[model samples]
Every structure is written in structure tokens, then in C-alpha cells.
Target: MTEPSTKATPTTAERIRSAFARAGGAMLAVEGLEPAESPVHHLLDDGSFAITVPVDGAVAQLVVSAGQAGVQAVLEMTDYAPLPLREPVRSLVWVRGRLRDVPASEVSALLDLIAAEDPNPALLQVNSGNGDTDRDTRYALLRLEIDSVVVADSTGAESVGLSALLGARPDPFSAMESCWLQHMESAHREVVDRLASRLPVSLRRGRVRPLGLDRYGVQLRVEGDDGDHDVRLPFARPVDDISGLSQAIRVLMGCPFLNGLRARRL
Candidate 1:
């Protein structure tokens, strides 16, 4: 028997809904900046529906007016970034796989092996899709930025082009270990967890918390040796208004107390 007739191809909204369904994530189409207000339409499942189109504020309007200046992401050079690291707080998931005793502190080779395994167009897209000749150079630059970010994140800034490109100070905190932590939570998560477990101190979120400020510095409490001493990460307020974790790590590394802590941990 012949199959039943199907309707014409669904709308973009229908396709979007279907894609969300396959991914097991909810699809929320809000019209205004405030999700609750000015609801034009809502849909639980796939079908044609009207969407509220939020008016572009001055910022968005300016981006449209001037065009590409709004979107490109700079490398290690930029002072202000809307990148993931800019957030005041971040929940970092660093350990990817359950690491059985590797017998060495460095797993760089193993990570390289993983990288070698997945060398596909998807990987290229992950790195920097801007290599395509079809798109505008500006947009292409944006794609390269994203790709550069992922590579810098997966490998390391120095491993990618950022260290040379930006001549970035070895903020060590620049790695922040947060971006790589994403991989640790996925591909390297188990290994990271194993490493943490081996630490005399247990590692878990909220197990550590940033405490009160100390003399223009920030303090974090993690239960390890020294019985939860306030670990101060230094920060400097530059003439320019830029401040972040990089300052803290740079300060900690230079601290005599931290030098002792490093010696103890080693």
C-alpha cells in the first residue's frame, strides 16, 4: 500500500521546533527583551505561529546602522569582552572523563590524541568557520574569532595563535582553566574528577566560595591543607576600567605565601 499524503514543507518556525525536539531542549521564542511582557504568540510543539519582533534599542539599531563593527570578537588583545570569562561568577566544569591514575601530572599528549581523532569539517567549524570564501570578510573575521577562541580554549592560548598574536601577558588566569574545564566536564571530566578526588581536599561546587575582600584583593575558601585559609587572589584597577581574574592569578603567582602553597602542593 502507498503511504499517506504529507503536507507541504513546514515553516522555519516548524523546523526550529523540530530541531529543538530532537535535541531535547525547550524552544522559547520571545518577542520583547523582557520575556514575560508583550507576548505575541507561544507554541509548545511544532506549527505555524506569529512571533513577537522586539524593537531594536539604540545599541542594536547602531549595530545595524554601522554594520559589522558590532559583532567581531577580538583575540587576547581586547580590554572588554562579552566572552564567557567576563562573567563575575562562572560554574566551571573542567574534568571530562574519569581519569584512572595516569601516573604523570601532564595529560597534554592524551588531549592531543583526542584532537587528532576528531578532525572533521565540524571540528573546523568548531575552530573558526570564517575560512569560507563565500561570506563577507568582516563576518568571516567573527567566525575566525570564535574558532580561535575554541582552539585557544581546547588547546591553550600559546598552543593556538593568541599568545603570539596578542603578545598577551602570561596571566595564567587568562586560561582561567574555565574554558578547558568545559572539556573536562565532557571529554576530560572523569579524569578531572579523579584528579580532584586524589587531592587530600575534596572538590565540589559551593565547596569553595569567594569570601570577603581583603585589601583590594579577593579571597576564596577551599578546604585543603591549612584548614580553609583565605586564599587571596590579587587584582589591580588599571587606569583604564578593566579588571578581572587575570589580575588575581598574576598577583597570587607572585605572592610569597602562594609560593609556599605551590611548594606544599607539589
Candidate 2:
């Protein structure tokens, strides 16, 4: 199979959703509040997120002070390449919205809903403390009502509506992208070298590294003396499973008979 020149790429909404799905943490900036880092957050279907913060921390206090009107906030998540590269950041996703506290009466129900969607252990910390514990160590739940989302990458920045983001699903390969990229960089140097040959002469001159993978294609980062450049190598077609991914990589490497490649368990 030959690689397509004009390869398919993910839609803006899909890209945003995929980035959100993969990010393990976010930097939250709220109006009248100091910027904070939150490692525990769950993206809901409504484009909002349930985040856990210190009960007596600045963010929780702001949520209480801001009241029902909510506070203007932007949660930024950076998508980093799985492999080492000159430019490690692959993309940035900004979730701009209003922040408010979940009512004490409703917090339990909301936590249940979030846990059902994403069962992260950190969620349990919200209720781990008792009145005797330090308030600063106790966690509380807050919600961010997303108004708009913008994803910035090498390609450019694109704004996605809250509704559009809610409708789009993350790439099927998202959960496995990091593992696959790391595998390519460590275990398949020759394959990567062969794939680099497919690039234009100018790009082939640089040190090519695997940057990302999705149902659409594989992204490569070329580090030359000047700077880092990103390029996408679309598969013959989109793939959904390990078998299809292997076939696609083989096609990109121009070695149909390459063997003994063990499939990774997702």
C-alpha cells in the first residue's frame, strides 16, 4: 500500500477532544484568583469538567465567593510528545469557561456521575478527610462550565464550540498513542529511518522522530539545525486496532515482510 499525498486529518473538534482525553493535568486560571495546577479533573459530556481542589485553597474559596454567577476561568492542558524531541510540547488546549462550586447537597451525586465516566483514584480524596483533618489538605469538587475551546498546534489554532466538542469523540488510538510512539522510538530505529525516507529531501535531512499517532495518521517531528518541524504521514487509511496499526506502519516503512513485531496489549 502506498501512502496518500493528501492524507486525512482529524477535525478540529476531534483534535480538541483527543487532547483533553489524554491530558493528565491542567493549569487553571480563574478571575480574581491565583493560577493553580489541578491533577484531578474529569471532562463531562456537556463540555464541563469536575475538578478537585483543596477545600480551603484559593480556588475553592473563589468558587464560594464567586457564588452562582460563577468566575471566568481558562483551563489549559499541554499535549506533550511521548518521545523526546527538541520541542516536546505537541499541542495546547484552552478550555475557557465559568467556574462554580458544586452545591454541598449535589456534590455526592455529581461525584458519582464523574466517577462513572472516569474512575480515577484521586476522586476518592475529595471525601477522604474528616472535620479533624487540616482544611488545606481536604478536597472539594468544583465545576467549570465550558463556553469555548481552542486547540493550538503546529498546524495553527482553531476554536471549537462547546456543542461541537461534546459531539466529537476522541481518536480510537488515543489511549495507546504514547505507548506506540515510545515503542517506535526505542525498538524500531530502522523502521523510523525507512519512514524518514518518505519525507521530502529537505525534511529527510533532519533527525526524524515519531511525535504522535491517531486514527488518521502518524505525526513526525524533524529536528534540524534551524528548528523543529512537524509533519503528518497519513496511513493508506484510518485504522482502529493493533493489527491495522501494524499494517499501516509497515506500509509507511515500505517493508511488507517485516516480522516478529509483537503487538502491544491495550
Candidate of highest TM-score: 2
Clashes of each: 22, 0
Question: What is the C-alpha lDDT profile of model 1 across 30-65, one tens digit per residue?
Answer: 123222111122121112121111223332233244
Model 1 ranges off by over 4 Å = 1-123, 126-167, 173-207, 210-266
- Estimate the overall C-alpha local distance difference test score of candidate 1: 0.25
- Candidate 2 lDDT over 45-148, as tens digits, reads 76688887777679878888879998888889998887778878888998888889888788778878977877877676674333444545567788999888
Off by over 4 Å in 2: 1-5, 127-137, 263-266
The lDDT of each candidate is 0.25, 0.80
Measured against the true structure, the TM-scores of the candidates, in listed sequence, are 0.19, 0.91
